[model samples]
Target: MNAESRDRLRVTVARSFDHVVMAMTLRGVTYLGEQRAPYNEEYDGNDLVAASHLIAWRGSEPVGVLRLRWFADFAKVERAAVLPTFRRHGVMRALMQEALRYSARRGYRQVLGHAQLNRVAYWRSHGFRVRPGRPSFMFSDYEYVEIEHPLERPANAITMDSDPLAIIRPDGDWDRPGPFDRSLRRAPRKQRRPEELA
Candidate 1:
């Protein structure tokens, strides 16, 4: 499949409804580890659901993922990940452009994202300005910066029709849990040791 078809990007509300959450988590951990950043294996599907999840797939397999949430006046973009084989083919750019356009349509005045330190310049090229004198999210372990873009009327008004292959369901109701919820709920919790707790 070509890059565009391989991406097969779709926006949805439920992470558990689709099987790509596992692929996204694995790719995130692997990518973060390569950059010497922290990756929590215990991260739950709830985190993915809280944000608007966009997933890209190649045929039946997921290859890229991104998340976005509207907070007051701005839309916060997070967790943009594209597999190594899918990178540099304008995948991330296409995703971001779509997100910005979506945010504008939803009445957001700005779009913001916490850019990993290494990607600051890349974001700058997309018209994001780095804020000065703001507290950093990464603390001392790794460098990270906040980037923001003022959505001009022109860019915000553009819209693209949704893709059919990216459509997981007809009603766009992905918030409901799938088989994972039933299995996790059935699993017994581990008992704590008194000495270990102390």
Candidate 2:
């Protein structure tokens, strides 16, 4: 964005009906229309009722959008679509930072995204890491990598493998505990006292 447009950038949670439409409109244009992303694959059923959207606006015109869906152990951020004109202007960054804070405050342990393979560097720049052994997604023109952002890891949190799998799971969503949380429950090895051993 240019300096003037940068000053006008604003991001917010979709509060009203119109705001929701704006989010969808931006998504439709970028994902469905511009990239020609498969309509069926693009329109996952989680939108609207089960997800909340964040929209980046420049003086009332929506320019970027992303959706957040709650999972058992993390928040899944998906379908991030930004206007071609706004691609390098930090709009997505502003929206994602706010979403991360919001998810962390709501007691989520982490956030995950199915990021396009080519944009791996961009996502990494935002503190997202590709887990070891993660699956790669193949679409018409893009492959995806699962990226993660751990929120408030305790000192005792289990150390992830040098490479982890694509794990922010979708099966047991919202309320149900899922298989992906197994590693998180691993207890740190107990240290033995020298006196006891003797």
Candidate 3:
């Protein structure tokens, strides 16, 4: 894609339900359902925040996605995907680079991810290191190895709470709790009785 089209590719925070559907569908097709929770679980915006769902849109249609989870010292990257038509054209790499740059800008000490066994070399080429230990998660039949990228400075972390390109802060304790937590705490608003409604 050209710079203009690439620049037009908007990455925005999305609701967890949409994200979950996308994630589950993509993972299921790729045989990574073992890594996913059941799809019937309800979710809310806060759940999306905790997961840091960044939906890549080409105009109005979402074509790619990536999720981020930030902690006090580090950020975790996961569930990255790009639609078939968008693959091999640097969409996934662009999303990752943006996420890494964002993490570095947010003051996170590092950015970490669990790469599928088949993608270990791909991650290695991007400067990630495999942690020497057993896998903590599984994607399809493959195990995932922890990989991390250390940041040189806290100032390099991405700050998503601001304008124009505003994003949900991965860190907890913003104006509101993140999407994932919201999902956990969400309760249906009670409807008013007829008398109360009147």
Candidate 4:
């Protein structure tokens, strides 16, 4: 892709159901259609709970997706997919970088993923390495090995010390005021008298 076109690619958290659907569509095309991965195995019940989806958009086209699930001290990366047509343009790399940044911002120091045996080198290119001594495993007719990447905690990572409003801001959008922040502008409700309550 040209520099101008590459510059148009933006990775953002999937904040709404529509955004999640777009991510699912890319995964469906790549995994379900191309790879013939089983539907149950691919959509493993965890999508809507305790997970953050990242979508890479080249202008208005949703070209790539990555799912991140948070753990106490680590973040698990799963279901990374990019449209076949967009594979050579660094869409996966962009998604990986955004996932790392988002994880670090939330105070996660390690990121883990199950890399298909054939894709180990691709994961390694992004600084992930197979965990030593971990046995290879198989799922959905594919062999996989666990890989991990370490991250340095960012200085601005959210913590108990952060402002309460900042903590409640939308995922990966802590820098801007969110709907809750804007709602603070409304006047407080007046207290009802005992006579009015009766």
Candidate 5:
């Protein structure tokens, strides 16, 4: 990947069902097609709940994806995959950086991921360290090790003190007013009288 190609990469939160499917398609290509992971195991039920998906696009084509599952104290990064053609173009790095950035903005203290044993070095290269005292485990027929990255809370991190509108903004888009915020521009609806209803 040349510098110009790298400049063309854009990572964003998957904001709609279509965007979510695009992310999943990238994962399916890499995990199910390349690695032959079983359908059920790859598309576990957690995707639609307490999770956010990030999709990386090379210009107009979706090239990579990562999923973040929120927990009380931390966010877990999972199902990271990049198309084979885009493997050397730093798409995974972009996804991981965006995931960490989003997590920090949400005021999470740590981000966790399970790295396949062979890919431990790859995760370590991105500032994640193998969690000490955690034993190796196997899942989906592969050896895995727990890894975590510590995040410093940003000065503008979201909290109870944030504006209610900002708190309700879409994931990874806290800085902008959402559709619900825009709706506030309209006059409040008036209620009908009891006789009018009858």
Candidate 6:
């Protein structure tokens, strides 16, 4: 790794416009330009959310980006991409480590990812394993091998509220309510009565 990559590797949960722009540029180059995935699939509305974007920067330029979507039991780690020039320079590894740390802090027990078919070994090296009985997910042109990484952390960890990138802040005051578990769940909106509709 170069001195800049090793010494100045900075990872942040991106919410600022400037950082998001840099992240989108890098991801566009890798996922859209090189991989030739459809733009809709690559962008996939993840960047629009505040907390889903994780960017790794060297100085002011973003070199890598990753997205994490939380579910009831585990977090989905996806949309990882690194600029061509920065690949193999430790940008991806730095971003992955940071993502894992953030997940642990959020009290997530596991992190899951769909690693590209060719990049199975890379994900495996980071402690992601193929979940037993689950098959690889196919995405039209390419296949994504499923992988999961368990995070060991205290159940009381409540760091998500303090994270500015989080889309949903914890309910009530963090200091007073004490630690709690939460997952993103949406209930169906109530519709007008049948008579009103008629």
Quantify all predictions' global Cα lDDT against the true fold: 0.63, 0.77, 0.64, 0.93, 0.92, 0.76
Model 5 per-residue lDDT tens digits across residues 1-198: 666875699899999999999988888888899999999999999999999999998877888999999999999999988888888879999999999999999999999999999999989999999999999999899899999999999999999998888888886798888988999999989999999999
> What local lDDT does model 4 show for residue 90?
92
Give candidate 2 misplaced runs (Cα > 4 Å).
1-6, 153-198
**How should the candidates be ordered by TM-score, best one leading?**
4, 5, 6, 2, 1, 3
Question: Model 1, 47-154: lDDT tens per residue?
Answer: 544357666555556656667775877888877778777778766776677777666755577988888788899998877888778866874366788889888655
TM-scores for every predicted model: 0.60, 0.70, 0.59, 0.91, 0.89, 0.73
Candidate 1: residue 89 Cα off by (Å): 0.8
Among these predictions, the greatest lDDT belongs to: 4
Judge candidate 1 at residue 16 and give its lDDT.
60
> What is candidate 6's TM-score against the reference?
0.73
Better of 2 and 3 by lDDT: 2
Evaluate model 1: give its TM-score: 0.60
Instruction: Report the C-alpha displacement of residue 9, candidate 4, in angstroms.
Output: 0.7
- Rate residue 139 of model 3 by lDDT: 46
Residue-by-residue lDDT tens digits, candidate 4, 1-198:
676885598899999999999989999999999999889988999899899999999877899999999888899999999998788899999999999999999999999999999999989999999999999998878899999999999999999998899999997899999988999899978899999999
Q: How many pairs collide in each candidate, listed in order?
A: 0, 5, 18, 0, 0, 0
Clashing residue pairs found in predicted model 1: none
Which segments of model 6 are wrong by more than 4 Å? Answer: 1-7, 49-51, 159-198
Q: What lDDT score is found at residue 101 in candidate 3?
A: 64
Question: Mind giving the per-residue lDDT tens digits that candidate 6 earns over 65-157?
Answer: 988887777888888888888889888888889888878766788998887789888888888998889877788587977789999975546
Model 4, CA-based lDDT:
0.93
lDDT of 6: 0.76
What lDDT score is found at residue 185 in candidate 6?
42
